[model samples]
Target: MSARRRSISFALFGAALGFATIATGPAKGFDFNIFVDPEDNYIDASAFLARGGFIPVPVIITEPAVDGGFGIIGQFVRTPEHPGDQPPRTMIGIAKTGNGSTAGGILRSGNMRDGSVRYKYGFGAADMTMPIFPFGLDQSVDYHNKNLAGFANMRMRLGESDFWTGPRLIYRQTDVSLGEDADLGPVASRVRDQINNLFDSKQYIALGASLHYDTRNNPLSPTDGINGVLRLDFYDDAFGSDADFRVGQGALASFTPFGEDWSLGILSKYKWTNGDNPFFTLPSVDLRGVQSGRYSGDAAYSTEVELRRQFTPRWAGVVFGGYGESFVSHTKLYDAEGDIWAYGAGVRYKLARKIGLDVGLDLAKGPEESIFYIQFGHAWGRDMD
Candidate 1:
């Protein structure tokens, strides 16, 4: 072949490949999405990085410090070919909120079969404000917390179903600083001292087994299916943990489809810790738009339901309401702020159809405050299930 003829042929071939990719990209479910809060009001902008497969894309984002800023909740994850999954690529990022609270972490994750597995180990630090004094006059306190947490699990398919029985281990070292609060100081100090090593830094190892079942249509945004997890873990000094305790936790979610493109998702979570464990490490009312760990206790449980309707091809509307509370004793359920109620409405845009994931914004009202969330993943969230 002559040099000139070969060069012309190569150019044509390259052009053909580029055109093919552009044609099929949408069908393959790859896209980028961005949005701002107060959808109609346009108060702030929100964006995130979520890519599947192996596309080497570089991203540098700077979010202006306004309306409590933003944080990296969860990033784009790799998709598996079949029921089993694997981890994605190595990732690292940082987040800063508007209320003078900042948090950041680095993660290395993947699944062997190239599926989705919520397995990652990272370190994070946050300076936060908690409304821990529901019975008191202040109703809020400022605290600083730093922690290193890791999730490592190995699973095998069970009985031709998406359910998996696996042994998993969780580790965390939390060092908390409960600073002075003139209004709630005395009571807060007494509560902190009651729990051994609660005010200072503490480390605990959770070694246990989990039975997880997930049949959600989409790992990202499921219009149907059930995802549930039952976990029993133990922390003891024998495991080099500063506190000895037994932790039992379970979370179950089910999405049902009803009238015309409408789906109802119901999710419930329960957690209990027995023994000398740091007060902050227990599970709290993890609801939408609520302050992180705003309500925590030795035992906690909650249930929430969200109804979604596909009003448009790429848009869906969501309305959700839930109630949860944490308490040291059963009688505390009647205490002030013991019963936490939250509800909100939001809009969702199908961010990426391939994974069936949706990006959404919700305006939620907690017990005594209202907040907004720009969700990277579905509200039901990710975990062993």
Candidate 2:
């Protein structure tokens, strides 16, 4: 072939390669959510209720400052809730002081998304030397430490919609402590410290790839419009495991109807662990059922589903229920083996674009007893993707 012909052929080959990569590369999906609370209204209400719920009397509290101080009661009150229409992306609240007075404040979050790559980083800390009244107890303590954390995630899409593929990466860390005057039992205090560190000092790194249909949308909403997500998570350092590994799978689907005024969603998640789960990386509510970390000889699993309905542009509701089970050869918390089933319902009101307010009540049944959970948001996928 002539030199000019050969150059043209080479150019064609390069174009084909580029096209193939674009068609086979992972599809880019992201969670880029943002929220701004103009005032402390929501947090204040949550705190008042948390305090009232714990104790028989109403405990009046003050607003926390925006410094390094914190107010536990106030923070708990200001914590945000999930609504069926949107995702849970951020939190804002006041810090507390040991004197039951306001000290500093806090802001925490991890949310972002752009084309084929998405990332999230969350971190916040506070030392509220404040007083606390444990429900049903008359004693109040004057010391507490706020915990902080952050994580990042990224993904690249694969092939066409007919057969999809991608990879994910994540990292997380946290710390917590009690006030000065209060004295906690050795076990309880240690437990508290451990819980605090779960999201504080510890770092959990994860890497995994997923495959799905081009037609299905990952379950970002409580309702599926004929699309869903089937994801598998593998860990290189599942909670500092490094060489130790664990895996988790999650399925989310949803549907909409009646001119988008109503919808329903379902989520089923299962996780299995091998190796002893790291000492500090078990699983807990703070991590929202996501696989955290573990060592050899340890294993755990969980499954859940949610239903939601939209009544109006500004009004909607959701119901979610699930079961969680776990086991370990030797862990102070899981030695006996246990399972928990939970069910709840909530309502939402959209106050702005992709921003809304939510209130919900959940009842959880376990091997030990029945517990109630009350808070905000629809609690499904949170801030629908």
Candidate 1 TM-score, C-alpha based? 0.72
Per-residue C-alpha lDDT of model 2 across residues 1-385, encoded as one tens digit per residue: 0000000001111121232332232213212111212242111122222232221111112112111222222222222232221122333334333343332223233222322222333344433333332221334433343323333333344422344455555443323345432467888777776655553444446666655442323222223354334544555553463445555544443454544565555544443455434433343321122211211113445455655677754446666666655555544433423345556565544322233333333444433334343333334432122
Point out the worst 10-residue segment of candidate 1 by lDDT: 1-10
- Candidate 1's displacement at residue 212, Å, is 0.5
Residue 42's lDDT in candidate 1? 21
What is the alpha-carbon lDDT of model 1 when measured against the actual structure? Answer: 0.57
lDDT of 1 by residue, 112-193 (tens): 4334334544454444433344432335544555566665666656666677776767677666766554565777768755
> CA lDDT of each candidate?
0.57, 0.36
